[model samples]
Target: MPQTEIQILNHLPVELLSARTEDLCDILGGPTVINLGGKRPRPLVASSLLHGNEHAGFYAVQRFLQMNIGELPRSLIWFIGNVEAAKASRRRLEHQPDYNRIWTEGPRPENKMAMKLKQFIKEQRPFAAIDIHNNTGKNPHFVNVNVLEKKFLFLAHLFSEHIVYFTEPKEIFANAISEICPSVTLECGIVGDESGVDHAYQYLNAIMHLPEIYSLTETDDIHFYESVARMMVPPDTEILWEDQAPTNPNYIQLSRQIEEDNFKDVAKGSPIATFGGDGRILVMNQKSKELTDDYLSYSGNQIQLSTDSVPSMLTSDLRVIRQDCLGYLMVRRRLEI
Candidate 1:
């Protein structure tokens, strides 16, 4: 479709994104980007829709742009990632393109969208990039910060005195985007929920006014380093894996020792967590276990660990690992990064 200048509100669904880029330069001819030329450059880019069904964040982004275009930082840019998937409301390109997974290996040399975003980011080199997303569940409050160690501490200082990080360096969904810019993902909760929309709006408001955010700064860099050091969990702690499939519930647990003295016949409904070649965690839940009569009669119930259950190994004698967010607690541990 030919891109044109977007009014944002009425035309949001029609690709204001393509418009932004087209307006900036006729390089590709559609709608280009609108560069905010100012004495001091702004370093923020807010983007969304890496996942297809995650539409609330994208909508919120459009709404935010509408209300605060003038107050927006001079160098800030708004983007819609995975435009194809978002358009179809699916996870990725029909069956071949996985927008979230594309970052795993970096943009394909010839892939148009990936190459375009990569080139744009490289040219701008913003200080921070905030990507919005929807969690798999109904809870709208979860947020994930998957930053390179060098950028972790920078986030801590910029965002809050308390910012959480994944214990290990797993292949993250946003790795490709973050590799070029400081980044954060706001899980705006489950879509279809008005509260989720509200959560996204409030978050956008806070980020827009955040004092710490600007073109990259030394102070921001220091926090990034500290975040890297602070979020690494120690080895030896076992975290039970929860599957993300639609049929499964997400929760982390301590793996039960199969060789322990207390080991008995497998329970009929108990879950078994295993791994594949690259250590990809696989969770077999009670429903499947019961079908196979694995062992005891255990029902799958979703539960978060009590605050007291946070691994003690993280105390005075152990290394300080990342903590959970306000009103949330650390539930399970992940293996070494």
Candidate 2:
């Protein structure tokens, strides 16, 4: 099991922001939780670096603390996670569990740490919770929530006009915290983009001073989607990149610019991928049941959409695609806000 011991501190070490990730680990130790207290009774919680390669959250939080300097408008609890992977500049080591996935319930050390965090939430009763992340694909900044409550949408819209609600891949930090307080996951573009860092920092600053998170009176302008299914490459299948077709029959040749389709509405019969031989693509809902022709189907060798939908988190990175999934399929949700 990976090291799950958490460190709790009451003060912010400003210099650590300027230091390298590995250096930050050396200074702060591991998975440190800090409480920057203010006059407010309940704190706002921000978590970052669940995936080590995604650095926007870390940098944004760092910059936010730097700008505030002294007392904040409200108390805040910051959870800095996956310092080991951050130090190595990868997502997570092969042996380690995904930090975000272990938050629900389990026996693993990471899950234990997650339970501890939940305890803290129960005790402190935070006003809101934010988990900052950076996507590996070309997509707009969006917020993800597990529940469609007014306060959740309000908090999500405060970060971005695009919002996604999903219940799959359970045990994520956002889902767990949403039960206690209005919580949302902010996807701030990709790693190392200064623009993403700036956007997240600004959003955090704005939320810090808010008296309360309430449902919006008018939300017609907001784009809401419900993630219903995940698209995946078969475990035994090999993915072929570039324009060249694969010699192996089990390979799937995805579009070279597959990730570019992210966040765009797909019309019915749009091609998503093509196979080398008789190999088929896999589409499964949150329950892990294979979707039939209602969602997607194969025409000759090409995989095409059978319904109008939107996909998110499509990535060209082969490793990420293989380890996680191709992306997620979403449908427009009409809600009264």
Candidate 3:
């Protein structure tokens, strides 16, 4: 079958127009803020498909423009990031590598596609960039606000209940987008849930009209890291976390060690957390905000504990961190071919 790329904006459906690296730069032209009359003032912008499969929000944005039409908030601008991925219904560029994992060095302005987006953002320095995606499963609706930036807390405070930080900080502040903008990544609840889609659509509506409902505030007193923690997993090992672990607003895990039965005590590489099943093992991975700090020890049995540094988002190797460091954090995949 011939592949079709879909770029739907507002209620009007546009055929996926292939961008010459130059044309894409034009499309990524930053936020076009419109000001409608309101007692308070704020800018709300939304974009989706930083990764392809996590496409629920893109549809939500589409539904939003359809229903609201001329009624959309004056200051709100709806955006679509991975025009290429969304068009193909896949995650990243097929021939090209994942975009989300890259951000260390800026995308070459001369590069066909990246330059287009670079120019767009350069032209429109939005107040915030609300990227949307789906979580791995059907869990409670959640939001990821990269914690390093102070502006992220505003989102946590504004949304309160649904916020989930990707860091060890127990507070609502630790989100990947926190550094980039007062941004939020809406995990609109399991990818396939239509209700999740509907609910997210409502939230999008609420955000566009944010100034109407909540008072706006700003602060610069926030914690950001120069160096990041990296996770280096040895071969043949799997890792998992409790779903509720990130539920707390201020919870941070410093060091975690896994106790598995695969290794022997008398010999090398003792078991840490067992992989799969009951009583298999216990595990622990250290979580520390400051990279220079030492991990606190738990006074129990010795498990196979390793402290993996948090990967830098700015690396050529995208495997280091879980969140998008630059641009919009997206699902890590491709749609082309």
Listed per candidate, the RMSD to the true structure in angstroms reads 13.1, 1.8, 13.0
Across residues 1-337, which tens digit of lDDT does each residue of candidate 2 receive?
Answer: 2357888888888666586665656777678888889767689999988988889888888888778777888899999899888888887888889998898779888899989988987788899999999987888999998887889988999999898988877789999998899999999998887899999999998888888887777787899899888888887787887586677778788888988888899999998988766666788887889885678888887879999999998898888788878888889888765
TM-score of each prediction: 0.51, 0.95, 0.51
Q: What do the candidate models score in CA lDDT, each in turn?
A: 0.42, 0.85, 0.41
Candidate 2 lDDT score relative to the true structure: 0.85
Query: Candidates 2 and 3: which is better by TM-score?
Result: 2
Error of 2 at 161 (Å): 1.0
- How do these models rank on TM-score, best leading? 2, 1, 3
- Among these predictions, the greatest TM-score belongs to 2
Q: Which 10 residues in a row give candidate 3 its minimum summed lDDT?
A: 326-335
- Cα lDDT tens digits, model 1, 232-314, are 22123233423332222332232333212111222323333332222211212212221112111223342222122121112
Name the lDDT value of residue 261 in candidate 2: 86
lDDT of 3 by residue, 109-165 (tens): 213333343344334444565666764422455556554344554654444343434
lDDT of 2 at 11: 87
Candidate 3 Cα misplacement greater than 4 A, ranges: 1-43, 107-119, 147-151, 157-162, 166-181, 212-337
